[model samples]
Target: MMKKFSLLVAAFFIACSAYSQYDIVIVGGTPGGIMTAIAAAKQGKTSVLLERTSHIGGLPANGLGATDIATRGATTGLFSEFVNRVKQHYIQKYGAESKQVQDCSDGFHFEPSVGEMVLEQMLAEQKSKVTVLKMRQFDSESQNISMRNDRIEKIRILNRESNKIEEYTGKIFVDATYEGDLGAAANVPFRLGREGKDEFNEVGAGRVYKYWGGTEGEGSTFQTDNAVQSYNYRLCLTNNPAIRLEVKKPLKYNRDEYVSMIEDVWTGRHTGVQMLQVTEAMLEENRKHIAKGNVSKIPGDVWGIARITNMVKLPNDKTDANNQHMAFISTDLPEENWPWPTSSWAWRDTYAQRLKDYIQGLIWFAQNDKELPEHFRKAAKEWGFAKDEYTDNGNFPRQVYVREGRRFEGMYFFTANDATAVAPGKRPVIHTSSVTASHYALDSHAVRKREPGKVHLDGFLSYPSAVYTVPFGVMVPKVVDNLLIPVPVSGSHIGFSTLRMEPCWMALGQAAGVAASLAIDDQVKVKYINGEKLQKILLGQKATLIYYRDVNPADANFEMVQQLGLRGYLPDWEARLNDAIDQQTAMAWEKLSGKKLSYEAGKTTRSEVLKSIYTNTAPDNRNASSH
Candidate 1:
């Protein structure tokens, strides 16, 4: 009886060890998840970030190092800090004036290895509060999530390292995964594929066939269908002989899959295409100055790897090669990834390998296929894998870029309507509870395979958008309690196009992390956190809620200006932060303060006008103060 009692005591301790508890549990170590953990740590909360894969930084860590920011300063917060650290690494390693610095393009462009290193370095800073567990995937074999009503009690993870099932319980849960697997497992409501254009009034919604490089919305069709944008691996390639491992032909290479490229080459489809230069700095001075002429041929268009894909320069003589946006049959493989959101790990791996083989086979075909022109073949031969990147994974990117997945049907429906301005050169509709901002174009890749007479692949479109705010409600689901999903957020397909960018993901992740901490501290559900308080905490972290050409996170009046923007006040209309307030400002102040308070010329600036508004409008502005 004594021996049996001792064994029972030992088992209880072991079970406790297996069931780890933290303040927050975040799934997916993508930039969003990483930042979520970091932000939670900042708020004096402990979090456990579980990554299914070996590395954390997601697409940027893989090979999508070239950021997709049209307006760079629109996103700051932890993301800005991340890029600044990356830039500092280059400056420290190779002097600031070195050619490597120029290629990095202000730290936005970097090698895959450097990206992973910086992400790991960031995790190290918050190690005490943020625990990262890689190779721990959500167990989908059974009902893995323990939920009481709408709240997820705990999540079951299959530790690939230990090959054992484990449980993680937390005060708050965050679904940072691109696929939103955790939320799906918890039975949170989500939308899998495209919504009809009329469903959200999104121009490029549903089964749309849109053409590019011509008119913006010429010759298009919109219909309702369940289609997802293609997924591809962003190859980190290099022609530099010191680090070049020529792409080897996959074992199961098939010629028929790549035979279609011969037709593109035979015609002038591959020629005269706008040469997306290696880097913005590399754009010829003539092109930059817009030298117009009756020019028949463009420079760097005819041959080489550029014919196959678009290569953006990164530090240390490496290139982040992505799908050529114009090509229908480039890296993007559409129509097959619909099952990725709720598929088994075995299915995802099989799909992952399929893309790996397809890309490798594509490269192999370009190099060795006799059906191609000789000059083009030789040019393709010049490029190879960057040997320094993904060294453990055969000089290939470890992760396939999953651009879109299960979007949570949360409190807010952020759509294409929010991204584009009602009128040009003005801000979009402002959200008073805005937590972060992004300015990436509404760029969606092909959602269908090749179709005859379809000039552009079905569902491939890119349109520039105004800087926009993503509200705190975007990350909060309506039906679930104590859960926050930053990626695969509650937004439409067209809206996800711009929000899908990693910088935006990181910013959202940071907000989710901080929001999780706030929920735990206040003993409330994530949906019920004080809106003004959350925005204040984010501002304290140097996050930008609105884009101002003149004002920045560094400015003393940054938070006040952002606060004013939140109240639907456009002081100077052109984002002139220093400009004195006009009738618009006076009107906004009167609405907020309930008193007609007008400031004299030079006596009070726009910042002062906004400060007054923020103080009067906010229930408790103590936490919202910037100074």
Candidate 2:
């Protein structure tokens, strides 16, 4: 049976390769992959974007409507363009003053269908250069990919629609898949699971237990393990009867999967499912409960289905439902996803279907199960899958939220420290070769299943992160000369939590497109491309590479100030163009240029001196890539 199956799989790529050679071939029609194609299109570079799913957009298209953004300033360029288009989509479809427009929250909040429509609109604009082939999964056996030396030449992907293997040759290949399947097939060295605490000295490294998303401290004895974070479906749900479908029990429903929730309800640990309506009294009560450190007892006033699941609001009375952050028993299925990174197509599909069934069963159990409390069941009964969303998939989302995947061992390895500050309350490490800036907490979901005496699942951590820059090196593989990975990027497990956010991934995708174009233009390895030139091109496209407090994308001196910031002159947030340089700024400047800067109380200001230096100095002399 095994031999016969192997022969059947081998028959796919035995035929001739389809399509002409492209300047860039990107796998995964994720938001990152989509932006990559669009960015390449802007450069008049023809590219092909291959998606495994029927739809193009990843999570955002599925059910991730509430955008995970720390600040609007961190997301720009193509991502900003995408958001503006989403807002416009609502404005045109409904009126500019419609309730849907107000619900969009400046294009940040939206429905899954709206998100997909906006993304498709963005892709449509690049129809000339970007050819999107949906339902195409790349074969990741390391045999289908043709590699000459360290560069990828072509990849053979199985077209699920026609059951044919189509070969795509490209000057530069990008692995934007959440799984990093193309990179793995091309033999890019990568890391799976958690790194040891001492390996990177990352604060959240290793396997251990912690509370309320506060990660373990550095230099701990916890050992590294192949325990990836949990995976789940971000279900788009609505209570509106106009477009609501019953949360029916899946065909293969199993009672054991959700039987544990009954105990949670009895102990008052599992809250009701309705979205919470908070008041000042509820807030104070919740605070005191947490301060007391007895999580088994949630405040009576705040208990509900909201405790176990997150329902971030959207337009049309819908929600982008997700696994609750602090909920011990949530939608996320941990430990079982260990095989997902390297699993075969058949195995993955089976597992995904099983997971889909499992969640569907859980919802059914919550709504109609005999063991669940009457009030809990009633709270859940009002909810159902949004009928208008994912109509082909029976209102269920298509993409399962694969938060972390195979992180490549690239030129730069991002650890938890990158998201942390140099000192307490200070900015994170400023990269001179920064391609983008993003802000998100180190939010890793549970890495293990329920364990005895643990408040939350092990490795379920989340804490604040400083707004930090992502260096170009994170996307450049050390050995893959022509390949770049923007999604399953070069990040450690803890560091990946922040980079995994869709908004940041879009920015990284933009950088990958620009870098791929540069590599082809200069006829150099992706690593050898000029960093300053890449930053300049991205700046021209309106990307915010370095984030500052006072100076934003709107500032007239934004580009110059950002360049100066890279040179270590403007260390603080504010540019303070006319204000005298502080001691910290003076010290940072001296450290960069080896010259003494005199404040003289008031005469010298930031803009006066910095702009003069910038105009006189040649671009190469800036030494922005010194880091």
Candidate 3:
């Protein structure tokens, strides 16, 4: 009888060992998931991060070393720290005065391998508190979620190699995947396509078709559709023969895809004139380079009929190439990515491979096609994949760039109106519980083709926008009590165009981690956490919750600047107004402190006015110290 009892006890313990609990379980190891794990671990939470592939850092570490940032000053918190670390890495490797160090002085760009190294180092710093499980994907098949009273109790994950299953229970969960797979598996309500203008009163929320170098177009500004933006892999290429892998024709290459492109070039539809028209100086510069016997290296004229010439310079003669719009060809394949977000993992892998094949074929066609211009062909041949990058993936990017994906329908729906500052009185609805600021333009790639050779560039709105705050509600789902969605966030298709930038996603992930830590510590639902206290903690973490153009520690009113900035009263305080104590400064002070001040001569200096503002408005109970 005692032997039988021992056998039963052993079985029970083995089952329990298979299921473990953590303070936070984050799925997906994109920048957002990495930041989430780092933040939660810093807060002393037992955090676990699950990545679907062997690699992490997503596009930034894949091939997109040229950071797409709108306003550089808006970067703060963990994202800013990551950039600074990359900057330091470059400075340490190359001398500070070197061109490579100067290029990364703005703390934005770096090599793919350098980015991967820095991200891995960050994980290493928190290895004691954070656990990273690679090649573990959330199982959507068995619907393996244990829920009780609408809260997710545990999630079952599948090991891709071994096909073994393990359960993880977390006090709070974060859906940081690019496809929103966890939120979808949890049965959260979500909208897949663009919403019409009337649905959210968004002026830039619909389908659009425009001809290249022409005004011919059709479609309402608010027309709704199920179409999504195109996705592509950001290729890291090199011109140096020492580490360059020449473009090879894929086994599945088809010449039919190049027929239209060749015809367009012959018909003058794909000439380089459209790019030259950007400025007369650029046209002159191109002519000068061509006159100097650099026929194959003329600026903006290297791609012939293909529009794959958007190459941003990286260190050591490398580049990060992306798509550009030409009359006939573009790097984006909108039609091929329709089912990627909803497909199974196996199907998604097949789709990714097909995209890789198509992009490779396009490159080979541009380089070796006989009908193309000889100069352009020679220039294309000069560039190839860098052998030093993505060594495990055969010198190719490990992941395809998913520009936009499943947006969570959360408590606060950030719409185009919110992003465009088009609320009542043409002012943005300010969120007092702001956590991070996003300043990128509402930029979306092509979504559909209106006709042959003409594509509808829907969801593209380039407007001067202020650095806007992302509210905490954007990450908290309306239905899920314990889940936080940092990427694939709660926003409309148009709003997500700006919020989907890499740095913004990292900021949101950091905020989600902090919120998750607070909720776990207080033993409360994420929605019930104190917003003010959460904001305080975020500020302590060096998060930029507000925008100011000229308010740093150097100012005498630095405390007042930060205090008012935290409440979202200062609009462009970062703008260096004239050195004089102007009336505009007084007006801003009045708006923030609710007390008007006279800007009379000799009445008060700028420093005195700021001191008074700080004395009157500073919170007495809260500690005023920087992190």
Best by TM-score: 1
- Models 1 onward score TM values of 0.91, 0.90, 0.87
Per-residue error at 361 for model 2, in Å?
Answer: 0.8
**Greater-lDDT candidate between 1 and 2:** 2
Scored by Cα lDDT, where does model 3 land? 0.74
lDDT of 2 by residue, 1-627 (tens): 999998877775454343547999999999999999999888889999999888999999988999998877886989998899888888998999998889888899899888888899899988988999999988689778999888788888888989988889999999999998998987888889898887887776777665563445332346799889999999888888888889888899889877776765555442222213334455446445544533424443223456457898888889889987656677888888889988887888888998898888878887888776666677778888888888888888888899988999788888778888888867899888889999898888888877654545778777688889898888888888999899999989988889999999999999999988988998999988888888999988889887888887777888998888876777666778878766666666656655555454456777766776677566643322234
**Tens-digit lDDT string for candidate 1 (441-506):** 888888887777665677887777888888888888887888999997988888888889999999
> CA lDDT of each candidate?
0.80, 0.81, 0.74
Worst 10 residues of 3 by lDDT: 618-627
C-alpha lDDT of residue 621 in model 1: 45
Q: Which stretches of candidate 1 lie over 4 Å from their true place?
A: 1-19, 216-219, 270-302, 571-577, 583-588, 601-604, 608-627
Residue-by-residue lDDT tens digits, candidate 3, 228-302: 888889988888999999989998998886667654333234323354344545545554554453543333333
- The prediction achieving the highest lDDT against the true structure is 2
Cα RMSD (Å) per model?
5.7, 6.8, 5.0
Clashing pairs in 3: 548-574, 549-573, 549-574, 549-575, 550-574
In TM-score terms, candidate 1 sits at 0.91
Give Cα distance to truth, residue 429, candidate 2, Å.
0.7
